[model samples]
Target: MEITFKANKNINQEQLLKLYNDVEWYAYTNDMPQLQQALLQSLDVISAWDQEVLVGLIRVVGDGLTIVYVQDILVLNAYQNRGIASQLMEQMMTKYTHVRQKVLLTEEAPDVRHFYEKNDFESCDKGSLVAFAKFG
Candidate 1:
């Protein structure tokens, strides 16, 4: 039940990529190029493991000193509701609070919204600022 934070450059990309696919929040089913880009953008990431088994992960994409968007905060299905995500967010906050531009996007579901709130996020009103995405 130990959480370990490591820079993406220091870890095995293949294992970390596998963890990314294992998350439920992964929307694209077959987009290797995009996935690689996503991995490259993550300045800070962590893998939660019980010994050698990877159970959860958190990734942040942005310039480490400024805008960090927390993405793919996930824990295995069996590991849900156990404060694992909370702990991951807590770790991120502790490490990057001074960045002053921390943000995360959640799916359009009540449960997802609740999860974000519990981790100290609130709904923002960005009038006329549309958020866009593409799935391949």
Candidate 2:
């Protein structure tokens, strides 16, 4: 499949919701408005499209100075192993390469760690700082 990349924020809410739900990310789907607003206000967004379909996306949040957090990265299940996700990460890393602190929080699954490590990310447990989060 020939996938195209978009570095814009003109996505529709339904597309976003569907992608999130496809990955079983119910936290974002639970509050649709908040998800929409968060996407709207993100520092950067990169999306992959197959024709006009929203096939993959990665979003970041940052102050443009010191820190940037990867808020999301997802691709449709059927579209996996197509290099679409690698493209998204390449663009995001290139965009934030000069930033002092880059971070992302995710599940500790082996595949997830492998993906991030392949992209030059190290787990906090292996680094000097420990990661902490308080979720309701």
Query: For residues 3-91, could you state the per-residue lDDT of candidate 2 as single tens digits?
Result: 99998876888998888999889999999889888888999999999898899999999896799999899998989877788899999
Name the lDDT of candidate 2.
0.89
lDDT of 1 by residue, 1-136 (tens): 6645444424455655566567644453366566656666678776677676666777888887988888768777677788877887888778888897888766676488778867777766444434666757
lDDT of each: 0.70, 0.89
- Local error of candidate 1 at residue 124 (angstroms): 1.5
lDDT of 2 at 29: 94
**Using alpha carbons, what is the TM-score of model 1?**
0.73
Judging by lDDT against the true structure, name the best candidate: 2
Worst 10 residues of 2 by lDDT: 106-115
| Ten-residue stretch with the least lDDT total in model 1 | 3-12
TM-score, per-candidate, Cα-based: 0.73, 0.93
Give me the runs in candidate 1 sitting further than 4 Å from their true place.
1-22, 25-29, 32-37, 125-136
Error of 1 at 91 (Å): 0.6
